[model samples]
Target: MKEYNTVFPNLIDDRYFFQDISIDKLPIMDKYNGMINVSAYTDAAEYINAQDVTFYGAWLLNMLEERLIALENYLVYDVEKPELVSYTNTEPTGVPVGYCWT
Candidate 1:
């Protein structure tokens, strides 16, 4: 018979207590120029007071702005009234082009 190790998601280790570890082991934070003392009680208050950060120069914002302009153009100018668009031999249903409402 072969032996195998079993893994479970919510298992807790018995050897190490969380309070036994010091905060100095944490990597230096560029934002604060120091390692964070990750006490749940203290950090929760600090996080509440911290200002929101946004990536204003992100590419997705520019792409979304462009999409908004294209959508505005599509809704305002590119749309043809159903009666104006000449689909060969098909009668206009009077709804806007591409909206197939009965």
Candidate 2:
């Protein structure tokens, strides 16, 4: 069950093996009939898929159940509270020495 469209980026599943984006297909043929063996493309789609899961609305409900359980274990510990720092929000800070230092 495969479909082609302009927005394939918006329709990828993460839990299954995607042969098209696997290590065997790492090398791609360019427009000039040249083979480019790029390492990043091999797993790039998987990383992007993970990012999508992280940012998807209520996606945490699907993924964070384990993390929530792990966090619950720490609830029993009486950790010391860290000091809260305050700062003025009038402008953006951390400008470089010369580039857009205004």
Candidate 3:
């Protein structure tokens, strides 16, 4: 996997991503059923630069596409080789069958 710094060089030393802020400390409230509100804390422009966002978005899309292709290949392998599938019994004594891809 690529390091965070390698993917986002400009954000390497940025505190927003690295800082461990507790979610409980945030100004959040359940106003209604399935509805919530939270306060904004950072400068939007600093966090959402067009160039950086675009680059990261494209990179994320590419990574997701690659993963999807890999998963498709694995599924195809399972379909092609039914004899290779096996089952294992867990502590509860339930058998779950699955393909073991190397």
What C-alpha lDDT does candidate 3 achieve relative to the native structure? 0.37
Where does candidate 1 stray beyond 4 Å?
1-57, 82-102
Per-residue C-alpha lDDT of model 2 across residues 1-101, encoded as one tens digit per residue: 11112221234333422233333333322211231135564254444343312222234353445444444544645355443433445544654444331
The residue-by-residue lDDT of candidate 1 on 36-66, one tens digit each, is: 3444534533533352322122333554555
Candidate achieving higher TM-score, 1 or 3: 3
Candidate number with greatest TM-score: 3
Model 2 residue pairs with clashes: none
Q: Flag regions of model 2 displaced more than 4 Å.
A: 1-59, 77-102
Question: By TM-score, is 2 or 3 better?
Answer: 3
Q: Report RMSD for candidate 2.
A: 18.6
Roughly what TM-score does model 2 have, to 2 decimal places? 0.19
TM per candidate comes to: 0.25, 0.19, 0.26
In model 2, what lDDT does residue 42 have? 29
lDDT per residue, candidate 3, 38-99, as tens digits?
A: 33323322333322222233445555565566557657764565454444453323334664
Native-to-model Cα distance after best TM-score fit, residue 44 in candidate 3, in Å: 17
Q: What root-mean-square deviation over C-alphas does model 1 reach? A: 18.4
| lDDT, candidates in the order shown | 0.39, 0.36, 0.37
